[model samples]
Target: MTNHTPPIIGLAGGIGSGKSTITKCFNNLGVQSVDADDVARLVVQPNSDCLNKIYQRYGEDILMNDGSLDRRSLRTIIFNRPEERTWLEALTHPAIKEEITSQLSKLTSKYALLVHPLLFETHQNAICQLVVAIDVPKEIQIQRVISRDNTDQESVEKIISTQLSNSERIHRANLILENTGNIDEMNAKVFKLHQNILELISC
Candidate 1:
């Protein structure tokens, strides 16, 4: 089937940079949004093949008593080991991408706001007509992650290490939504950028 319109707006940013907030704002505007995080969660849901593979590969250490994936423990295991991280990524990303592609195939909107922490890193940015990065200073990023994830500096730093830097993210994005401002100000910025995006595809 031919799509009437394809996904166009991609939101990529560090863990605590408010990409989800911006995506929600767009959703309120009637745009369908696809979340890579949600997609990732589906990939590892209980009793899923991916979960079985992970259990077999990583052993039973990552499972909870309730038969669900212990995401935190799994994260700790992969955080310090590059080979294990790569192995897990290899196992999950393809399935995640397949599911996302199926979802996108059915999307009928001027654009879909695709929220991904590592959208660019996966070579998926090539499909997005425009990318918006909700930018924050590094100091703020570190603090936000530590606060939001309730993790210490060392773990937060390791997570950040896996992601691209602020300058690098800005360099790769077509637009930057700097969120250092107040809520009202940030809302205004998001609205303006939304308008600009509408104009871009309209032209």
Candidate 2:
């Protein structure tokens, strides 16, 4: 039988909540970290099997002039039509999950951290013993998205609507990492939490 020692920590949050930064702190401490967003970006690169399948399903209009996946076009299609979104997820999510699971299994660290935006929403709790949700205020998330992505308030609301609410995620997680502070504060909180996670994982 295959050994089933799983990841020790799962870091989750909605977009613009500094989940990447939190994962980086763990990286500095020599923890193995895998980010789903980064994986998603890689999985959708030009000429990738996922991108080719999407092109076949959705047509060439979804490609930019440079022949890369036109994320805006795909996003518009997915957001405007839930059916389309489900189709894309059906095609891609399994591949993402399988790749992540494989990478996690290959890690040599004493513990691993899965940094996922939708850990709770996708019910990936099986991978990690301690699920830490980064708690950022809804308004802050909206403002960050608006400023960082140059998107409008309506789009921000729509993206937020797609995610599980902060309270719901908090209730689902084993721990919560509040992240509505400056970089120094964020680093401190992450460091403290990493220690706690190490202790917990050692149990």
Give me the candidate number with maximum lDDT. Answer: 1
All candidates: CA RMSD in angstroms? 1.4, 1.8
TM-score of each model, paired residue for residue? 0.94, 0.93
Q: Cα deviation of 48 in candidate 2 (Å)?
A: 2.3
**Residue 124 in model 1: lDDT:** 75
Instruction: For residues 1-203, write the lDDT of model 2, one tens digit per residue.
Output: 02754555788899878887788777887888878887888788888999999999989899998878998789889988999988998888888887778777777676888889888777777767889988989999999889988988988788788988999889989988998778788778878988888788877
| lDDT score, candidate 2, position 37 | 86
Q: Give the range where candidate 1 is weakest over 10 consecutive residues by summed lDDT.
A: 1-10
Q: What is the C-alpha local distance difference test score of each model? A: 0.84, 0.83
| Residue lDDT tens for model 1, 93-186 | 9998888777777787677787889988887787788998878988888898888888898888888889888889899999988988776787
Lowest-sum lDDT 10-residue window in model 2: 1-10
Residue 12 of model 2: what lDDT? 86
Clashing pairs in 2: none
